[model samples]
Target chain A: MNIPTLSELTARGETPEILFWVGCAGSYDDRYKRVTRAFAKILIAAEIKFAVLGPEESCTGDPARRAGNEFLFQMQAMNNIQILNGYGVKKIVTACPHCFNTLKNEYPELGGHYEVIHHSEFLQQLINEGRIKLTDTTAYKGKKITYHDSCYLGRANGVYEAPRAVIEALDADLAEMKRSKTRGLCCGAGGAQMFKDAEKGNKEINIERTEEALNTGAQTIAVACPFCMTMMTDGVKAKEKEQQIKVKDLAELIAEAQGLA
Target chain B: MIQQILFLLTLLGFAIILRKRIVQISRTIRLGRDVKIDGPTSRRFRNMLLVAFGQKKMFSRFIPAFFHFLIYIGFLVINIEALEFIIDGLAGTHRIFAPYLGGFYTVLMNVFEFLAVAVLVACVVFLIRRNVLKLPRFWSAEMTAWPRLDANIILITEIVLMLAILKMNAADQILQHREPQHYPSTGKLMFSSILIPVLEGYSTSFLIFVERFAWWFHIIGILAFAVYITYSKHLHIFMAFPNTWFARLQPAGYISNMPVVTREVKSMLGLPIEEPGTNEPPGRFGAKDVNDLPWTSLMAAYACTECGRCTSECPANITGKKLSPRKIMMDTRDRLEEVGRNLQNGGNGLDDGKSLLDHYITREEINACTSCNACVEACPVLINPLEIILELRRYVVMEESGAPASWNAMFQNLETNFAPWKFSAADRFNWAKD
Candidate 1:
């Protein structure tokens, strides 16, 4: 039972409770949910009454579509559209880029459309609006961390700064990947790749991406995409940097600054 | 004497045919990518001079490259010698016009003849390498159905070209004004016998007669080969320049925007939701027909040299996933041919056209691709597989409704959970360890 559906929001006169479309990466990866929840709390404490999706929130048909299961993808897309329309939720927020992309881009195929923003952009907006206060000093105030732009978030949707802004806002030392922004290398997680194996290539994309971050001498690895965070975390562990470095999402970084974590 | 000139004119016709074919192929390959421009201005210019006129890309493989260089330079330099010999025959007299052309031209022609010999030797070695030694790696290129025939034609053409180049020297040696009747005895091939030793004790008249006879043979051979090459897969000589030049401009990540699916001609706006147009719309969002494909899709067939580089790097193919990168091009070619064949009988392809996804490619094959872009990268021609596959997926997801079982559940979960899995949407930030 999802109370935050688009229809219910419109019925309740909250024309935009800010429908949060949590992606499967965020759903299964509990760490990301914390980030979203923290972002959500900003809206909540602001009395914005942000509507968080529940049981009705599922996978963005992207994985299905990438898997060539277009029928199932459209069904999911159509179902989600109906869910959004029923709730009359015009604006949606997401921590996962894949969800943001699928809903914002792929949903029209199934006839569902809405105003969608990446959590970074929404948070940046909130920060700009002065709804959320942050300490100029963060846990990683002097620590160097590199931010990996997720393919879906940065390349597909062009949401580069919001996450970086969050990191910079936290007053953390930031580094860059060689192939950042438009040329950002895939984290071996696009087009259903996270669910599959690395095909023939020089390096596993996560490791390759991790190596880029590592090359920046960033001790802490930060990412917005759940897949990127997980993949980078795994890459760090494999490189035996588990003891030397740490991985954190933007939400967690913001939360840390506020002493919430 | 007049027969020699007629023969040279016949050869010129052949070169004209070849030139026409190469141009057509160039145009066809230009159609494949979505706005591919080769390097920067200087780079394109340099590449055009080097790759197109200079034959630079061929040098990537040394043996073949070496031979091809010789043949190419050989013809360019000695082409006038063959032409002049034809004119001499037509004039019904033989004067040493080649020497009168200028000392530099005479020396350059001599050097070109020697290089032509090198080219001949190189071609033979390459042919042996490909056919007798059976370099299995080249099987992809060799197995290109029509390409194999083209290869044979190229081999014959090269042999003839070499004969022509060698004969230019031969005709000069055998048919000059001093020794016009020595054609039978002065038949020496520059490719086979080194000119230094063969010129020993040879009379000047014999040399001129040989040169004249060889000149006629050379012109006919070069022309015939050119015409044949136009319709062949080796059409890359003309096609590769533009194909490599107009590689994709953007990073591989840019997915082309899907067309607006609207009912009316106008009224489309950002955040497409309803039919904003004045006319009725189908409300569907994916390409439904060949007409729906980006023009790039059609261009793929021409850009494809059937090199199999794409198939070689394809993970799906290596994993036995049924998708062959070469076969994709072949399939495209087959469809185009079918369409053309049907059109010849006064039928539009619409009635005969079938969905390639369901016909040539199975659902399993489509699902098997990881979309890694290895095929895209490995392709010497740089055919972007990611875009093609995604478009196919769009058709599947939006138009066809075909999908795997687990994939279906994933989509269902996406709708229900606002994600792709069975988890709640609230737990996204639970894993922060820093």
Candidate 2:
């Protein structure tokens, strides 16, 4: 499969429909890289004209700002805004809730305005438009799948329904964890918590959240955010249930169900 | 006439004290940095109605919400009777409204009596929940001695006040029978009439004394409670309205940008600055003390009811981490009180070598937050403890450069490589290479 970068598209004198923001985690984390590919595959299958910023896409400075380094955060934000505004980017979609949140909500103030949509919402839109069709009798058919709400996506942005709708489109039983949606527990990796070890606590936050997910007796834990993907995968491993249950992103699940993976 | 004069003096004295206390609180809140909180007025008014007056968020916990609603309605409705007390005290008349309203007055007294009983029951249950059941929320580390005592004192005081009103009503009913000239019949009240059996067989003079004593005690207790609210967490009763009205309307994840840093960065990048060249000195990067936070945040600190709802919902606190969101608000309020006291004593404010940072809250507590917004979502009054955490973190990282070593490395990687990890930006598209 051939994927075009924004620079390549610009040189070819063509503009794609949406700029796919492959966040720091999506680009660098080995496990999350697969999610990036799976989501890209879905976009290709749907014939959506999407291009990536690739090397030109810097961090959205979500971590910097969250960690209280405003000077560094603004420096990075201003740099990204210059590149994005120069490209005349009008729309952005990302698999990372942090990037989606910063670009959609925080960027307009810094003058990088764009309609930012999380990948889950984008996927739901694709399915709703019948752009991507799933094959019958897929791996998740009649199976119980639980979706973990990323704090940035759930309570932070109030985008709770789009991801759930995407999950339901798979013809699978969507079992909800005890704490989901507004009261959903964090995966223990926000506010730059992903970069540093957790402070002294009785138990890890991801483990607690995983316990809630496991209590639902679901066979798969579906996530939308790459950060939650890493944390929940670690949690499933910690509980020694990696073999019995699998942690998959919503895009990966839809891609596999569509026979595109 | 002498009784009327004495009542007027007491009322005037307490009103002055209450006004002074409120003024002091407002002044302390004003010490915080001013930030414009412009938003749709209708939306803010709607938020106040739903969250504060409507008690919408409280209903999340049914049992407690039910009891709290009882007390809240009781406080509002019973105050009507307190208004009558003031009037009767001023005119030296008995049941002044009773002559005009007649049957409706009995209905109003019966409703007030019913609410008094409800308040009495709710307060007892809350006292038991705190002391006997020992709900974990009320016993968190920050609850300490005084907080626990403060909660108990208020609950017990409410119970005592309710009983005093009932006793006064019963004595009045008995005096109406014996000395109709002084205590004219206002019809039998429902819940208070239940106490008639307890007050029966008492002499007319004795009954009048009981009536007068209970009346004085109940009114004085209410006056004291009003003054006490300004100093206690119960300030939420009044502050919740304004706090909810001025709550942050943006998504919970949106940490407000530091415009000062924005201007500096714009100049460095050669981007046209929005407002160039101000005469004011550059302020500290973030909050080191209460005065550094926005006035809304400081007001939120004063408005916190110390219910531990935020703490109970906090992931860090739930996991046994040092960061209790309740403690953050409590400490902010405590530090603000200290500064207020310092200013009142004619000493330098915020210069006593004490601050909200290490003095009350610690670096460890602030670092533990995941910025999950659980506490913000859990807050019944729209308090954002995460905002406070973020402000303090800005102070630590930018002003003090005291982030943990790992975070510093992450910041370094973000600076050079444009990511948190030490990977080349060139490798960003390698994920698409299969």
After superposition, candidate 2 runs with Cα above 4 Å error: none
Please tell me how candidate 1 rates in CAPRI terms: incorrect
Model 1 regions lying over 4 Å from their true place: A1-27, A30-190, A193-261, B1-101, B110-129, B132-136, B140-149, B152-156, B170-193, B196-217, B262-292, B345-350, B353-362, B426-434
Q: How would you encode candidate 1's per-residue C-alpha lDDT over B39-58 as one tens digit per residue?
A: 47766566456655775545
What is the per-residue lDDT of model 2 for residues B1-434, given as tens digits with 9 covering 90 to 100?
A: 99899999999999999999988899999999888787789999999999999999998889999999999999999998999999999999888998899899999999998999999999999999999999999999999999998898899999999999999999998888888887767898988888898889888888888989999999999999999988898889999999999999889989998888888999998989987767799888899999999999999998999999999988888899999999999999999999999999999988999999999999999999999999999999999999999999999999989999889999999999999899988887788776
Number of the predicted model whose DockQ against the real structure is largest: 2
Candidate 2 accuracy as lDDT: 0.92
Error of 1 at B291 (Å): 5.2
Looking only at chain A, give the TM-score of model 1 against the true structure.
0.90
Per-chain TM-score of chain B, candidate 2? 0.99
Interface root-mean-square deviation for each candidate? Answer: 7.3, 0.8
Q: What is the DockQ of candidate 1?
A: 0.14
